[model samples]
Target: MIVVGVDGLRPGVLAVEWAAREAVVRAVPLRLVNVVPAWCLHDGPTGAVADIGAWMRNGGKSALAEAAAAARRVVGTVAVETSLLGGDPRRELIEVSEDADLLVVGDSGMGALRGLLVGSVALGVAGHAHCDVVVVRASAAGPRPEVVVGVDGSAAQTAVLDFAFREAAVRDAELRAVTAWNWRDPLGGPEASERALAEALAGRREIFPDVRVRTEVVEGSPVDVLRHAAAQAGLLVVGSRGRGVLAGMVLGSVSQALLHVAPCPLVVVRGR
Candidate 1:
């Protein structure tokens, strides 16, 4: 099943709805989840913890019903279910993600201060989710759907490419394979860098034989280059991190930045 985390059925709910429709069309079950913060409890004598819990449950059901209705309008009939959870939104999402085929969430919510800051829930899920996570921004639109995958010639990149190609196939969109190299090192000339990129992309051609594949070798920061390229893409896919454990632990700067500024939906694949 594809699990989507909803926060009060905000405007960003549309993104997850759209993704749910996509999932339905693919014949996957869609589950809408709402997590009420644990702090909603009242510790004082006047605190109405029971009342608050009841309200949250009722609200959760209503939100799920609305989501289901919206999804039906687009998908006709699909296996859909809803749930209300308690505790930290991020932590709950991570736990629920365990059984999810794809976990979806909004990029930023009601308190967003900037375009670059993914909501805390999204950040936590992107960092620890055991499944694929799709971060959808409210400002995102259009359907020119192109799959943009970041490659840095690491074993982890193979997983990224695999996911990108498969998504492009499912979406019937163009697959763009990108590699960004820093030119600060004079020892590796532009020609050498270009050669390396070509080699990396060349290794993935067989998997995407019928898909229209394009390769880009840019000479700038990976994050900047990727964000620029993602402007016209429908989906931007990248590994949870990159080449080494350090990159994974720190969150690949490129993926982090793209999650914030990319104009399209971002998919972060999690694994070693």
Candidate 2:
């Protein structure tokens, strides 16, 4: 498991919480990574042209230290590792994701405008990482007991279902599997949409017998339905294609809308 490390704002601490939660669940070590611009090596603390990258390296180390401490507090001192990636932050994170079991990131800010604008690094990594990605936002007032996932019947559907079921099992929470379509005469009718949702989750039940799943087929936009369902959820899981033009985009919306609207943590599964 891996978590993004940064200096300030909610992500650093939030990432630690989420990554630590998974670490506890999977009994795995957590790795914290901070990506720095390679050019930072030229920046000097004395305002000089360059500091041989010492400043950047030290900064990364400090962030990793804070993140590690937070994770220990959250998961009662679990095994943790740290690393620093040079060059483009987004590219480096994507590379780190290739070997990580899961990747967690924080939204740049909490303001509506800020949240809506997914950081370029987060956007890039979410779309390209080989592992699953979870983006944390808004603090919770209390514990939420449900995990919601979207089913689009795309190639990514299986991975999304598996991820949702596994997470629900891990959290001992109810899984709400949702599918939405534009309301119309037939193609968008509730019956057909409900059947599609059932088909999409067909064999997944056998695979995850312990997970209790409730299916929902609503006549509305996919993102809107998902946003509504996630109102009381602890996590919202969605699927995205990590390759080509759709890279990092969640449900054709680029992850901006939900990241801004959903009051819970958002997990964007990189689909096969």
- Model 2, 45-97: lDDT tens digits are 45443564676678777878888888888888688888776676667777777
Where model 2 places Cα greater than 4 Å from the true spot, the runs are 3-5, 41-47, 51-54, 109-116, 184-186, 241-251, 254-256
Q: In candidate 1, how many Å is residue 123 off?
A: 0.6
Off by over 4 Å in 1: 9-11, 38-47, 109-116, 185-187, 244-250
lDDT of 2: 0.72
What are the lDDT figures for the candidates, one per model?
0.74, 0.72
List per-candidate RMSD values in Å. Answer: 3.1, 3.7
- List TM-scores for all candidates, in order: 0.87, 0.85
Highest lDDT scorer: 1
lDDT of 1 at 216: 84
Which ten-residue region of model 1 has the weakest summed lDDT? Answer: 38-47
Question: Cα lDDT of model 1 overall?
Answer: 0.74
